[model samples]
Target: MGSSVDAVVAPRGVVDLRGEAGAEFVAAYPADAVVVVSGLPGAGKSTLLRRWSGAARVRTVDPRTVHEACEAVMPAALPYAVYRPWARLEHFRLLRSSVRRGGPLLVHDCGSRAWMRRWLAREAARRGRELHLVLLDVGAATALDGQRARGRHAKARVFARHRRGLERLLAAFTRHVRSGGPLPTPEASSVLLLDAVSRSRARSVEFGAENATR
Candidate 1:
């Protein structure tokens, strides 16, 4: 195991990256911390991870990647819904295994499941790491356009449900940022809130500053 950790590190609440102009945001964390990237469907989570300019010193866990791999082997006429459960199960298994490895991680989530985050927090804490969050705040129209661009679409009701989950998470972070109270996230150390501009302008998410050069 790595060195022991006492508590969540500095930058303990929300770091809102929305209003800053001109500078690209570079997120820094401990060498093996867990960073979760969350937003609504089509919020560019996958694209952002793919666009990392620096050498990747972290492992990324993307559900879309899992789904696509499964889709490729699936029968053409079978809708994704038919095998959705299996894909989700695979994703969970992969994420769990990845988390257990105890290296830096970048995860993609929709902010829809409190239990998932809670479990992640527990696991990270057990491993002497902290869970960080990166949230992309975007409008419904923009998300839909993203889906169309990628040839994937979330049903209206499903999108609405995701939106609600995001709203709740955002609200919790908002309160955390404003009041400096207990974090809604179990054992989560920090969160970075980003709007479309900031999200587009972000340069990279680095595990540790040393990785940027390596």
Candidate 2:
């Protein structure tokens, strides 16, 4: 069973990655930071990383691409349950490898998994690196629409769980920010909140000299 976690609080800083300014901000984001891009299954985490993967010193691990490849060859009627365990195993194996060989890493996250976030935080801390979050705040309807557009969808029960977990996380962050309380996770140095529009506008994820000092 998953370990129980306390409510997540706001981070040290929150930035909206929208417009030219947002793009520029991403370009100047710290090179050494470990950024986790999190959202519901179709909230464009993969899309954003695909655009920015070519940047120097930035490496990304997206499990969806691998899963998609496997799906192409597998029978359409085969239940995902059969291969999901293997896919998860491969994803974490790659994630661990990336963390071990890290310079700058971007991870795709399904917002429902608190254990994954905790593991990432511990890994970053162990390596003396900072972990950050880039959370997508898209509505459930928008996310479901995206799933259809991508021709991939999570089971209804799974999607419902994701929606609830993400909503709670967002709400907790909001409350902490409003109250000016301690951050939710000290392991995470900062969090960036982006909507669909803002995510689209961010063209490149760059790391500059200025960020290295932070």
Candidate 3:
């Protein structure tokens, strides 16, 4: 049943950022757009944001940065669990502050958290702005490799949960596209999917005319 629905709603215009052509697509992206960079924990979202950090109109917020800051104040041997709640509090506090400021923003997200997406969508709506998603479609093995390379590892169970949730989100996105139905969320204007290879070759994320007014 679900498979049939997915077939009907498969995305038709998903851009593949694989080569020189992909650079053109990135160039056309709208500036002043509110975008979420979502993927597994280690899928290079922070790296991508760093690449765009120099843009005058772009402001980025990543929870991991908060987590790292919290870690610095504690014992080197202490586990993250001890201060996890404080990290979460600080992260959301910053997000809320960003939303209030109302400018072009980029946020890092692990694709599993539906509530966070919904919250972002609501904030966008309230601000009369549209939210966009840049989802990295790297496989679990590659994502795990990324985690190891970064020297940060999510628990096995947590990683499994993230995989399941991301799969469901991708499926929903595909189905919505194939069906030509209303957008998954009125506040969300588009979703862009990229693979690991494509992500590596991409140079910049440019904002187009759509961002001119904002």
Candidate 4:
């Protein structure tokens, strides 16, 4: 861990890491900062979150875990889509509860839901904590490879939706930065963009008072 993002610090803005290589990122911020790890369906958002959560010793509101718990008690023949609504509700509830308690929370988001992003950013602001984005910008082909690698294939339509959402999001962020307009979303003070290479290169994400969680 040799580099810092300075994401929510002075002159707060986007901290792009797409081109960085050979540097293990140590994303440091306030102990209370809320970070949203976002990307397409196969962009490895959950994987990165799992790694960072262990390293940062931070609690995360991940819907996948909720799905797993729900799956454990349900009939084996039933598809996850049948109970997705309940899972979503449970995830939302957990996220709200976690945010209320507050202090260096990491959220796994697919970047496909604008409303969720807005809500997260607002909730963080309400708690006097900054909301930052750590987006994995790996493109479509690579993302699809990731899905196959994980053996979790997102439906085609859903994957397309996520891709489009991510494209629009990145475009909006670019325009905002170029025009010096408002942030991409509510209460989002900074965004850190990373690609597959950079994400892998990042060893850990540390939150306040730096401890070697590895």
Query: Which model scores highest in lDDT?
Result: 4
The C-alpha local distance difference test score for the whole of candidate 1 amounts to 0.77
Worst 10 residues of 1 by lDDT: 1-10
Model 2: number of backbone collisions: 1
lDDT tens readout by residue for model 4, 1-214: 3334322222147766676676465666668988889999889898888888988789988888899999999999999889989988988899999999977899888976888888888888887988888889999999999999999998999999889989998888778766868767645777878898888866666667443322
Candidate 3 per-residue lDDT over residues 26-91, each given as its tens digit:
323444457888888777887877775564348899897899899999999988898899899999
* Minimal lDDT window, size 10, model 3: 1-10
RMSD per model, one decimal: 6.3, 8.5, 8.2, 4.0
Per-model CA lDDT versus the true structure? 0.77, 0.72, 0.69, 0.80
Write down the RMSD of candidate 3 (Cα, Å). Answer: 8.2
Total clashes for model 3: 12
Q: List the residue pairs that clash in candidate 4.
A: none
TM of each candidate vs. truth: 0.85, 0.81, 0.79, 0.87
Ranking by lDDT: 4, 1, 2, 3
Top TM-score hit? 4
TM-score of 1: 0.85
Q: Extract clashing residue pairs from model 1.
A: none
Give stretches of model 4 more than 4 Å off: 1-11, 177-179, 209-214
Candidate 1 structure quality by residue, lDDT tens digits, 60-94: 89898899999999999999999999999999999
lDDT value for candidate 4?
0.80
